[model samples]
Target: MKKRTHTRLASIVGLFIIASIGLYFILSNLEDNIVFFYPPSDIEKITNAKTKIRVGGLVKENSVVILSANKIRFTITDYKNTLIIEYTGILPALFREKQGIVAEGTFVNGVFEAKNLLAKHDENYMPPEVVKTLVK
Candidate 1:
């Protein structure tokens, strides 16, 4: 009986060790894919300018400038603060001035270099992060 109990305890311990290692690997992989969301008001507080993030806000009116055929510059505002985004891609069909949008990229030289731009699907749609900033 004593031998049997020792074997059972050893097996349980081994299983727990394996489970912990598996969980560690899963979390480590997920960490790389997690993109944080921020509002224009919080841009000044971001310490790591190289880290990729998503900025959600409304496009400032008359702030869109077509710098080139594929490059564009625009300002995003959360009513309290504003951020300039530079993108080199096709804008979504729904993207327009005074509309809700989320741009994903890294901050460089005081500007957000967006690789992807997402616009609200409809007039009533607003990114939740942008809405949270507006509500405050």
Candidate 2:
């Protein structure tokens, strides 16, 4: 009976250790993959400019500038604050001034270098994150 009790306890402890290690690895990978969403007002607060993140807000009116055939510069605003965004790719059809958009990219030299841009599909549709920023 004593030997059986020891074996059971050891088995439980071993399983717990394995589970802990697995959980740790899963969480670590998730942290690396997670992309945080920010508004134009909060972009300045982020210290890690190299880290990829998403910014959601309205495209500032009259801020779009065509730098080249594929390059464009625009500003995103959360009403009270704005951030310049640079993108070198085709924009979505719905992307236009004053439209709600979510831009995925990294900030460099105070500008958001967008790798991807997402625009609402319908007139009434807006990204939830942008809606939250606008509402605030």
Candidate 3:
């Protein structure tokens, strides 16, 4: 090959290697950080009931039970099903019945054990899948 042709081939090969490395890191980061969403029904089918997962649903009406100053219990529903969620700590003002919520934790003894609770901030918004479920 001519000198110029050789240089061009090397440049392309170097670019391909760089791109592959970048893509690998990006995918690895996503796998570690991304949390999968599982509805109430899916949680039951999961064999690793002890594994932590994210559950999104609406707070069931009249289910907010305050057990103590820092502890609270409530039922989250997907309209078709419900799961009791327990949290101990300050809850967001937006955390209330009939509103959307995403709880992150494991399920233990029939209760959705939550380590963190995130309440929807606005009345008109909901996670897209949850909203779609509610609509149908």
Best by lDDT: 1
Candidate 1 lDDT by residue in tens digits, 15-118: 99999999999999987456456889988777788988889899999999999999999999999999999999998988999898999999888889999999
Cα deviation in Å at residue 68, candidate 3?
Answer: 1.9
Better of 1 and 2 by lDDT: 1
State how far residue 44 of model 3 sits from its true place (Å). Answer: 4.5
Which of candidates 1 and 3 is the stronger one according to TM-score? Answer: 1
- TM per candidate comes to 0.70, 0.72, 0.69
Residue-level error in angstroms, candidate 2, position 100: 2.2
* Local accuracy by lDDT, each model: 0.90, 0.88, 0.83
Off by over 4 Å in 3: 32-36, 44-51, 123-136
* Candidate 2 lowest-lDDT run of ten: 31-40
Give the Å error, residue 23, model 1.
2.6
Stretches of model 1 off by over 4 angstroms after superposition: 28-36, 122-136
| lDDT, candidate 2, 27-128, per-residue tens | 998974465568888777777879888998999999999999999999989899988999989999889998889989887777889999998565677888
Tens-place lDDT per residue, model 3, 23-109, is 999999887236556667666667777777888888899999999999999988887787888898889878878888889988778
Query: Model 1 clash pairs?
Result: none
Q: 1 or 2, which is superior by TM-score? A: 2
- State the lDDT at 122 in candidate 1: 62
